[model samples]
Target: MMGSRGTSAVLSRAARMRQKLQSSLEASALDIEDVSYQHAGHAAVKDNANETHFNIKVISPKFEGQSLVKRHRMVYDLLTDELNSGLHAISIVAKTPTESGS
Candidate 1:
């Protein structure tokens, strides 16, 4: 799968990053899904499948005391390598269970 280039690859990358964050932050709930097809054939779509476009839904107690920006910053910091590697855009919905309507 190292050479694969498609939504699956993107999802895989996201899962890998989620695993990294889980280890680092001891998250309570983490769900990472790929939404590349929603933007497929759009102006932002890249010829290279590795190009980034993701919608992430994360629920974690780590964000309990942190502001939205701070929580996003933590995720961004953790995914710096992925960002540099190819990820261009991430649509993040971060919440605690209470805030998530759960």
Candidate 2:
């Protein structure tokens, strides 16, 4: 008998990033925008690449005591796999909940 579990669902890059950040950072707010279209003609981006560029904004307690560089590093570390897998660039706006008036 075949099992009911057919093909597993694949998560989009933005969705995957959101899940990772939300779970790891306990973010009060999170936004991920795919900006690949803006870089369509850029030399580094291939013509067929879809989720190559992103703009991320996140506010979390995890960033409370971290410096700006540290916060950016934390975000980069979390998305290392994504970065390695054709995610070419990201503009991150990471902030503490307090800093964001949350």
Candidate 3:
């Protein structure tokens, strides 16, 4: 583990981000995967093995009419705090229900 507190803090932040996105986006489906292990030795990562990167997939009707840039921005905006606090990167896959092949 990432010095215990570091891992817990990172996980807590990610959980909070998930909660916020779930509530704010009203997503039908949402998945947030901690991808820090994939970047364990990168310079941007200062927290040893902490959760510094994430891959997020969300499906919501809210995304139905949004541009891709706009949809990405919406997620980034919601995660401003995490970004400020050592969340080095994010990959977002936002889709409407229909766009998700549902």
Candidate 4:
């Protein structure tokens, strides 16, 4: 069923975030897990907090030659908006396929 304001087609926040990361990094593999439940009552600003915490594991050739800092920065750049809008925290494991033993 479509939403009255045409928002029904909009992907969930986590799905959209995953899509953005995949596109931005050309990720060979991506796993985005919503870990908000694990951090109950841990958020600074708890208003409208949906999908605030996450654990992301990404394997991509784009990260092959990058330093850990650079790799994390790349992922953070892709999620700028989410971070700004109260994405409380994220645990990111960014690696190349080779490094990931995959």
Candidate 5:
């Protein structure tokens, strides 16, 4: 399925993030909102920057016993490549299924 791998290369950053988080976390629910436009004029943002900011909400069993900081760290760790690749900021709401009442 090398072609599928190639297809992923063309996905929007948000789509790639969604795929990564959903698969890695085994998330029951996942939402990824691109908020980059809100940072358009911020000093760190270049005129051509896209997918630099995001709001992410995820509910997963993997988070059940984890502390908030640990959950966030898990997410950050999963996205290290994205962070290194110009993804600047993320607002994350990491939750367990019970915590989210899902």
Candidate 6:
């Protein structure tokens, strides 16, 4: 029973978190997709009805010289507020211009 207050709250929270990351990092490229709807009714979702999963693709010079784990950590730190609050899992794909062949 994913009521209005259940999923929407997390979705809104996620959107705001993404917005903050985008603005703060001024990322060269950033993509945030709301895949929560797709996970609904799925086995893994299990009626969590919260911001439990995400696939983030970020390309920024800020990531230069940073290892994959460090880059992801940077992104996580930016959204620490949300992650600590309720955001569960985040799948990050961070890259720099050189690494991305850009």
TM-score of 1: 0.71
Total backbone clashes of model 3?
A: 0
TM-score of every prediction relative to native: 0.71, 0.90, 0.85, 0.84, 0.94, 0.71
Clashing pairs in 5: none
* Stretches of candidate 6 exceeding 4 Å from the true structure: 1-11, 37-47
Candidate 1 residue lDDT tens string, 4-96: 345445566777778767877666677776766666676655684653677777787778889989989988888898887767778777788
Ranking of models by TM-score:
5, 2, 3, 4, 1, 6
* Top candidate (lDDT): 5
Kindly indicate the candidate among 2 and 3 with the higher lDDT. Answer: 2
| Model 1 deviation from the true structure expressed as Cα RMSD, one decimal place | 5.3
Model 4 — which ten-residue stretch has the worst lDDT? 1-10
Q: Give each model's whole-structure lDDT.
A: 0.74, 0.91, 0.88, 0.85, 0.93, 0.75
lDDT, candidate 5, 1-102, per-residue tens:
568778988889998898889999999999999999888878887776989999999999999899999999999999998999999999999999999888
Q: List where candidate 2 sits over 4 angstroms from the true fold.
A: 1-9
Q: Model 1: residues >4 Å from true position, as ranges?
A: 1-11, 41-45
Q: In candidate 5, what residue range of length 10 has the lowest lDDT sum?
A: 1-10
- Please give, for residues 1-102, the per-residue lDDT of candidate 4 as tens digits: 666457524767688688789988999899999988787776474854678889999999999779999999999999998899778889999999999887
**Candidate 2, 1-102: lDDT as tens digits:** 445343213678998899889999999999999999998878998866899999999999999889999999999999999999899999999999889988
**Which of candidates 3 and 5 is the stronger one according to TM-score?**
5
Q: Per-residue lDDT for 33-94 in model 6, tens only?
A: 65666566656555566565677888888888888889888989898887776566677889
| Greater-TM-score candidate between 2 and 4 | 2
Backbone clash count, each prediction separately: 0, 0, 0, 0, 0, 0
